[model samples]
Target: MNRLTLVHLTFLSVGKPPAAVEFSPGLTVIYGASDTGKSYIEESVDYMLGASELKSIPEDEGYSSILLGLRVDDGRTLTLCRALGSDTIEVFSGDLRDVPTQPAEATLKYRHHPKSKSNISRYLLNVMGIDGRRILQNSRGDVVPLNFRDLARLAIVNDTRMADKRSPVLGSWMPQNETKEKSVFKLLLSGQEEPVRPTAPSNLQKQVGKGKIDLIDQLLDETRERLSVEANQTQLRDQLGRLQATLANATAAAGQVAAERSAVVRRRRELEAADADTQQRASEVQQLLSRFDLLRQQYESDLARLQMVGEAGTILGYFQTGTCVFCGAEPQHQHPGHRLGESTQLAAAVAAETRKTTELHHDLISMIEDLESQAASLHEDHARHTEQLEGNDQELQTLDQRLEPLNTDTAELLETRSRLERELALHAQIDQLEDLKASLSAAPPAPPVAKADGIPAADIADFEQVMSQTLEAWQVPGDNRVTYDPTTAELAVDGRPRKSRGRGMRSVIHAAFAVSLARRNQARGFIHPGFVVLDSPVLTYRRPEDNKEEDELLAYDVVKNFYSDLLDNSAGQVIVIENGTPPKSVRDRAAVYAFSVDGSTRQGFFPPLDSSW
Candidate 1:
């Protein structure tokens, strides 16, 4: 099996100095304090291979490109350079540590594409003699092109994943990819790839059945999500019934109150109209009385003037008999008959006018009395109307006050009913979805195909033996009887699952798994990446702050044992990233890089901003 080894990783920029780190072919240990870019080294290596993106850290600012050096099994050195935020990789023929000044031998895409071979994944897989491999992705015997990322996860374990509860064979924690991850593991174990199977002619009925199944699965997922957050259906229905009854009673009471309010409002409006009319009539009557009083005064003045005129006529006829006052003649020239006749006629006319004037004045007084009577009657009517209007207003106000609580109750009940109805609707929808899913599940399933599945039992037993030997060599504190469970893809020690152990134990077990897998591959001549980068593999051995229970379990000198075992027995390049220092003897044997924060030693993968290096 051909294996490509990592030579170095470098970060370059335009004006800023390059940050770089070289790796040993056998064992390289980078142990440092926190926040000194120890984990970043592992991340950059993975990114250079096929990871989607590189994490952005403040310390990585001003760096525009990353260079990864690789040495093939044939002693041919190559460098892969990729710009920041770009998806293309530039492949150089030689091990140029810094950014390449000349053009690259080949340019490849960062991502793996099945139809195209000009990608970094295919290029690296070809170099390792494992290109064009296929793995079963699902139980339906569906196969997908085996991607480099599948193998990268097995080789590159980060700090966060070092102590994961899941089995190390299952790289991603996603449950949906269990089959595919298991297939990848089986591939690493057996060195066998799933062959391509031909598709049968499509049947209309089968197509429809499959489509229905797919839709039902989607609906089931959605329904489950909804039901996860909803209350009990029976309880919701009961609450809805109660709300409906309460709303009915509230609505009836509100209707009665509304009717009573409407009646009072109508009466108030009628009273208002009548009051207005009465006021208008009273005003008219008062004006009539005033005019009538003025007419009565004129009538009295006329009567007095008429009486005075009659008296003056009588005086002129008696005292001025010598002269004819009527014609302005002397008494001797005037005719006696003319004077006496004129005086008598004048007195008669005055007496008649006086009688007429007196009668008119009495009539006028009677009219004035009638008008005053009418005015008084209108004033009384207006007062009565005003009182009635006030009474109606008070009644309307009382009706409104009575209706307030009823209206409030009705509104609240309606809102509750609306909420209950919405819940009931959701319940109905869920019920429908469940029924549909059940019906779809009742459909006939596709016939199963017989193909190689799971790691062979003999192969598993061999791997388990190797796992036990590795743990014993490291002197892990336990009676280690390692057994691999294919069903769960987990390893167990003395009938106890690895996940049930502490974080420290889990980390150690995870490291043992990776190291053992590599060694097994090398020993049996299986295909592998020939390198493993573990971040914080011995976490609990040094960092007791993670868990006190882990500290208690890992009380032995496991760190020294761990480094010593890897130095002596590791099959390929093993890069260990940790927090604290390893044993001095082990450190002396391995290529060790120490990082610090107080300018004591090497700062990190990226040099300090103030440093002249």
Candidate 2:
């Protein structure tokens, strides 16, 4: 097996100092604080190995080109140089650490092409003696030409991927990539590729299938045309649920408002009735007061007349035997039995009439007083009724104000629910039509391929043994009973799934998996890149807050043991990018680069800018 090892990586730009880092043939440790471009080194290496793009950072601003140095097992030192933002890599003959001054080497496209050997993927694979390989992409025996990226994903474990809950063999959680990823893993383990065998349906079957497919296509188009909404079925359902809840709330609120309005209206009616009755009573009291006043006035008038008569009789002196006061003649000339003798009787009658009229006047005054009191009471009642009515009117106005918006909200929610339901229905129809089309178009099932086609069960057991030994060597806190599940391509420790562990444990387990795979491949003489780059494999273990009892045990000396074990056992280059510092002894044994942010030591991969340079 031919393996390629990384030598160094360099960055160059005009009028700037070249930023570079060299790797050891054994273990290399890059450790430092965050934001110091430690992980950028890993990214740059992956970028040189045909990653889609290199992340842009502030430290990488002035750099215009990236250079990667690789030493083949056959003593050939090849340097790959790529310009910034360019999709092609320029390959040179020697281990050129600096920008090339001459240009007489092959240039290769970054992407892989099936018919072209000049691309970078094919070029690298050719160097590894694994070129022109094919692997099964699915159970149908459909094969795709092997690319270097399939191996690179396993070899280079970035910070974000190190703690991923997904299996290390899988690149992502995307369902479409599962079969291909599994096949790639099989290829790495067995060193044999699955041959391509194309399968086709019979003509008669194709004819029947085509007719059904055409009808399904038309139905699908119509269904899709009706699916005018932008949201998918799940989103539509979620929206409908939320809209229903909101509509229910709005309806309840509207009911409450209506109830409140009814109460206010009823109260207003009661207040109005009370106010009318009060007004009527007040009017009646006023009329009685007027009549009593008239009666009192008449009584006063009769009393005054009676008093005048008494005074007139007294002035005439008819009762005192005075001479002829009434007829302007002597009293002796008046007959004793004449009407003039009745003057005394007339005075007595006048006095008695005056007393009765005065009493009647007193009674009338009392009646007027009672009427005035009733009028005052009725006025108070009217005032209270008017105040209550005003209050009810204000409340009704407020409820009406609230009901307007509630009604509007309810209408909007209903409209939204209707729209969402329509979208959901359309989605279901499209799904059903697609399912029917699939059933009609599906070909006869291919002969069942052996589940363990490439990597056998014994190989999985061997791999699991390697992982258990690695964890045990690192003194990881577990029984170290490692098991590899081929179905999920995941490892379990002590009967617990790798994904069930905390982020810190997952990171450690993932690193152990990568290291174990590389070690196993090297031991078995399998085709591998001969080098692995791991970013932040021990980052979570450094944080005390994330530490558990198991993590605390892992943190004690796991970092030192991790570095020491790799240094002692790694057959090819193993680059570790982390934030936690290794032990002094391990640092002394391995090639260590430290990045600092406060100018204490080397600042970062990119050196400090000097105007003198």
Candidate 3:
């Protein structure tokens, strides 16, 4: 089994001699008065082992760096030096003071990360025979890589930690950490190491998947709404075919309507042209009738003039022998102005003029009759054309009314078909996404591993036995049938819960738990750091407040035997920092360091706090 033992812890000052605490393989104790920096020793050890930051103390003011010396199982010494207020630690081959100008190996970081070679957890965990091990981090059964800081909670116990009621394996009070903490303890007990494989999907991937599912669901809902019906792909395809056939029939019908509309348009245009021609012909016929009437009137006027002249000649010829009636004179003796021409010549002239007038009148009458007949024929033709134009106009109006509804219906059908096709396409996309989601959900799960659920029952039983034996050796009060509760990752003393006991008993039990773990690992070849630093483990014995007399006596006896039992824990290193001194039996067999208020003999872990300030 690989083991890591802390040889010494040294704190170096800027311009003064360094203060150091030494340790041995079996047991080392630093017991002294209060405020003597005993608790600081445990804190410093934890800080060097990758703690986030060291606690501030007045005695630590002048310290420039902290150095921790470790002896690996190979018996080689390695020293790590951390400068004050720095995140990097320098590693040396042997003991260190201040900071090394040139480190023997690469500098290590104070934090842990998977890809970092300088991380302190890797360096410390490697020496402890537990490297590349994983621990469950969350309920998803996802495992995070192992590091020494995770195990530090079990290996280092400060004053508060000793009084804490929670399990030593647990680092915080968060409930999420309960399972993981128990698993870590189980891993230490089992001593099996396994490299972590990051099989769990990343947070981004999970989030994206959820987003995709949501989007697909939303799209599916919208598509169904657009379709106004819920149907499978096959049903949708059938519907599409039906719609296509309907559209095809509708289109053919619309084409016939369009042809009828074109014919109506052409007929209407022809009627308009014919109506215009009819109007022009009617106007020409009316003009011809007006002109003929005027010529007939002129011929009637001429005939009247000729008839008057013929009458005057006839009267003159008849009244040749008679006296004039109006002038009382004979016609032969009348004035030349009033006298008519020779009777014979005048009569002939009148007869000829009358004949000419009569002939002209007849000719005019005949021409007028002919013109009237022609006008009548033209009028008949105009009337017929006018009637035909009106009928054509009525037909055109009717056709326009019929085509309007068909055009509207065709447009509506086309739009509806287009919209349905688009909705079908959207449905196809939604179906694809649903299928993908199903396949992903059916994916095989990761194989079950130890610690994925919790620690094994048999391993817990073995751990409980070791703890019970340790407490029995210490002669602890109450039943020695102690058991490590895997659920709480703590111990149950005499069937009672560990935290239910008093602070005095709790401190003793917590100490026993740490010591037992180190011993158990050393004996069983389990993975451990081979060292445990416990601060004020026996504080309850020295200062038992409000405790019964029997309980107080029990505490005293427990503290005495506790040290003796620890001395026998071979192959394990135990460092106990306390305010109370130990029993002589254990003191004689261990290395003991004492700190006092007086500066003459010992100045505590550092120079005098007053001098340092």
Tell me which of candidates 1 and 3 scores higher on TM-score: 3
Candidate 1 local lDDT, 1-613, one digit each (tens): 5887999989998777888888999999987667778889999999999888999988899999999999988788999999888999999999897768898888999899878989999888888888889987766577888888888999999977889999998877777688788888888888888866643224775678668878877876775665532568788788878888888888888898899888888887887888788788888888887887788888888878877877777778777766577777886777657766788898888888878878888887888788788888878888898888788888878888988998898888888777767766767886787777677566445546524346788888888999898888888877778998877888898889989988988998999999999999988889789899999888633341332222334544787778888888866999999876766786678888977623336877788887664
* lDDT (C-alpha) at residue 373 in model 3: 74
Over 139-244, each residue of candidate 2 has an lDDT whose tens digit, in order, gives 5556888899889999999999999999998998887678788888888887778766654445686788888899889988988888767887778888788888
**Runs in model 1 with CA error above 4 Å?**
198-453, 540-553, 597-600
lDDT of 3 at 587: 60
What does candidate 3's lDDT look like per residue over 493-564, in tens digits?
Answer: 788888888776788888888888888777877878778889878764333122222333246677787887
**RMSD, every candidate, angstroms:** 19.4, 26.0, 13.9
Overall local distance difference test of candidate 3: 0.73
**Candidate with best TM-score:** 3
Over 4 Å off in model 2, which ranges?
198-445, 449-454, 541-554, 597-600
Pick by lDDT: 1 or 2, better one: 2
Model 1 global lDDT (CA atoms, 0 to 1): 0.81
The CA lDDT of each predicted structure is 0.81, 0.82, 0.73
- Residue ranges of candidate 3 with Cα displaced over 4 Å: 97-102, 192-434, 440-453, 541-554, 597-600, 609-613
Model 2 TM-score relative to the real fold: 0.59
